[model samples]
Target: GESVGLHLPTLSVQEGDNSIINCAYSNSASDYFIWYKQESGKGPQFIIDIRSNMDKRQGQRVTVLLNKTVKHLSLQIAATQPGDSAVYFCAEITSNTGKLIFGQGTTLQVKP
Candidate 1:
């Protein structure tokens, strides 16, 4: 629930650059996809989401794409900024499992 003490993979990008974070999900039946951003000392915050029936969805400066063919998911951030530096996670939930699964985690580092 908290990102207070976690070591995650890192993805560095320059300011105003586009950043793409990818995740591979193991469950083919997962019906819901969600992307979360967790800054230090806080719980993961919702960024964007895509339904299994949808190939792509966009929210503000963020875009989420779902590839059922490869069981892959990705989040794209346009014009990355310093405030965007945080741990990003991809989550999937299925009706039968009733539990949300989170990706390994990736820390986005926006450099000046």
Candidate 2:
């Protein structure tokens, strides 16, 4: 059976430190990958994204790495702050359809 979801339920980090969030996906046919950050009461906000053709992409303070061979994905946040505390989710979209399949979310807690 095929599966699409997150690998962890939560992550804890100290303020001013870096944070690494991991996710595992199942569909090798998926073409697009995205990382989103959701706050306490807000919708998921886009962080970074990568296509299947690429293995890595970098944003302002975030980096998204994609490994198609093992079907793994990771998000790295630089200088994580208290404000960065939120639930993070990884989503994938295939070119065949516009629908996006979201993985189980991982809660990120930043300790000051």
How does candidate 2 fare on TM-score?
Answer: 0.95
Instruction: Report the lDDT tens digits of candidate 1 across residue range 15-98.
Output: 999999988887788889889999999999999989899999999999998889988888999999999999999988887877
- The models' CA-based lDDT, in order, is 0.86, 0.91
As for candidate 2, its clashing pairs are none
Clashes of each: 0, 0
Error of 2 at 101 (Å): 0.4
- Summing lDDT over every window of 10 consecutive residues in candidate 2, give the lowest-scoring window: 1-10
Q: Pick the candidate with the highest lDDT.
A: 2
Candidate 2: residue 39 Cα off by (Å): 0.5
Residue 22 in model 1: shift from native, Å?
Answer: 0.3
Model 1 bad stretches (over 4 Å): 1-8
